[model samples]
Target: MVVPVPPPPLLASHVAVRAAASAISHGRRVLLNGDHPPQVAALGRGDWVKLICGASFEDAADVRNLSLVYTLAGVDCIDCAADASVVGAVNEGIEVAASIVPTVQRPWLMISVNDDCRDLHFRKAEFDPDDCPLDCSKPCEKVCPADAISLKHSMVDGERTLSDPLRGKYEGGVITERCYGCGRCLPVCPYDRIRAVSYVRDPTMTAELLKRDDVDAIEIHTTGKGTDMFNTLWDNLSGSINNVKLVAVSLPDIGESTVDLMNTIYTIMEPHFKGYNLWQLDGRPMSGDIGRGATRETVSFAAHVASMSERPPGFYQLAGGTNSYTVDYLKKAGLFQSSNWNSGTATSEMASSHQALIGGIAYGGYARKIVGRVLRKIPEQFGRVHIEDHPDHLLEALQEAMSLVGPVKGYIPSHSKPFMKQVDRQ
Candidate 1:
């Protein structure tokens, strides 16, 4: 039997398109007056916001949509996996956002690479569905935030008999492209069938991507065990490091030695690092979507690093478990845009600097989680969904995006007269 497909929501699309246009026009006014692409200024002002499209997430369509929505929302940067196609997808999204609002400043495009295969961000979950017991509950599917796992039971033959009614095998396992190696699936597997496969990006290819005109930055994910692997990767990236406007090192907080490790890494990059550098204090890794509590680790991590008198020279930012609550927590901790050092004792040089104590925050799983809700509304029959195609969905998605971005951007509320009237007229 053939299933009937739902028609596109054309009327909603028209109204939403108008609303989206109004919102974009109103929200992006901040980009118009910046002398140094607002992103850089944001870094200095401590309000920089970046969208991290997971280092292992290579779904081009989702990457493109996320890029478009976040760019319009006024994020300062978009970080994605360091693959040619992924980089192209990010640029495509930025280009589309620019098309919607001519004056919208293009956020810097940052690519993520790993110095070692052990980094969690550079892996994927794998398993054979056939090995899974038919009687066991599929907790792996339920626990997966990315919805990367899929399993269905099918009959061994064309028909099922009374004695073999439950003898079907499982089919259709992990969607590799959608999996970001969260590892939620591994622990949930009843049969212990799930395995994580990790791989490091080739430095040669990453170097080539850096040389691209559209590529604006690169992020190196390191285990923080030592500087040897990072130094090796830096050597491999050598001259290409100068091609970008910024370089970021993403690392987990490793206690008292974190500052020392950061200093060592900075030393390795300082000579050839001809651009702005950033330190991504990755707290709790990929747990942002879990809940409000997930944000605490990163905020606490930021508080720790911000208080350090001799951490390093690069701008500091928070990541790993950031979500909607991050900004509020930062504010509560007195780190949001505060120029004063946490210890109330800034070096003479720091006192004269214009930069904030903490540069900004990067939203990863949580950012994607909020926007992915809207993207999921598009019908499956629509195939590869370009959110812009369904303006109503785009507007909903944009509004959702704004809810997260507005706090950082200080966006004018959508309820303002002009834009509300546009929505009302629709």
Candidate 2:
């Protein structure tokens, strides 16, 4: 019989150790340049990456772990819901990550609030499962990316019951905390029982959060219908506006009126805007957790905005449909780090401060979905699943996050990058 050779282990412990070191070194080098605030520098370099913890996602345990993982992977900003508890969770995660890699640069903590209730990011999906027909398929449950919906049924004596077809008394409905209100379940529900409940964040509460020392940034979601709502919210937060380093406005693509609306909003914020401003071009909001096609809308929106000569003054970033494929899509559009946007007619604006045409991409649903896979593998017996407690899991999660962030940062697979590879000897 011929001798057989054993394959090397999938991930050696030493590789992880080296990767961690590289992450710290690269993070500091990319983030600590003194030309501007690290995040501002990243925007100017067209490498800024923000991990968006959804404006409505409030699961603290998951948020904490996700924050820790991404912080290690070298994100410039971490955008999350405006809730105090959520903000605390993000900070906790960042602190824990720093403990692991002492040199890891801490990402700016951002809180998201909405001016208009009409914005989809501020809504929640809700319904009563009892209203459904017994024979009806639970399509909503299948479609939900967050796994927020649950249904159970039990069989009766020698027969099936409609009321309890799920193996119990039809005990199923949207889990409030887990639902990020993507609205995917709405169209799939055959009964049309799902309803999206929208609400605006309290400006008073948002201002208070902004005042906190831990919060570094704030993003205002608007419907682009008019600037009256934007003006009102801006005035409400004006007193505390100086507390944060950056103020971001999240808006949708409103066609020809986008630039005009942006200019109007910019004029309103110009006097009061104390720090850097970013325009989040929200394309097909909350659909990133779906699949590849979902990223198209946001990239297309970026292209359209990039082509405009008079696009307002602010760092332009992509949101809404951002996912793994977003970077590739952006490169194809000639907008990824290409400063020649509308060179023939591109009039200088506030964005001229940034070197790149597109500042960066914000990963929301897709970012969570990628890391949530690793998070789910942790055994559930706990008060809270601190990812650091499980070293192996933490390493795996960091790799997943790095895969998404590395491309934009121009991180190559040498020993200097976060993911360490085996060295060959002559």
Best by lDDT: 1
Model 1: per-residue Cα lDDT over 1-426, one tens digit each = 999654344455545544554565465433323345567667667878899999999999999999998887778999999989988899888877766665666889999999999999999999888788877678998899988888877766676433563588778899999999889888877788999999999999999999999999999999988989999999999978889988899999999999999889877888776677888999989999998899899999998987778877767889988888888888899988787434211111222355677878899998899889899999999999988787777877777777777777666332222332345534
Tell me the deviation in Å of residue 178 in model 2. Answer: 1.3
Question: Taking the tens digit of each residue's C-alpha lDDT, what string does model 2 give over 211-326?
Answer: 99999999999999999999999999999998988888999999999999988988888887668888899998988877789989999998888778888766878998888788
After superposition, candidate 2 runs with Cα above 4 Å error: 1-18, 27-35, 154-168, 340-354, 413-426
Per TM-score, the best of the predicted structures is 1
Instruction: For each candidate in the order shown, give its overall lDDT on alpha carbons.
Output: 0.81, 0.80
Model 1 spans > 4 angstroms off: 1-35, 160-165, 340-352, 412-425
Model 1: per-residue Cα lDDT at residue 405: 72
* Global Cα RMSD, each model: 5.9, 8.1
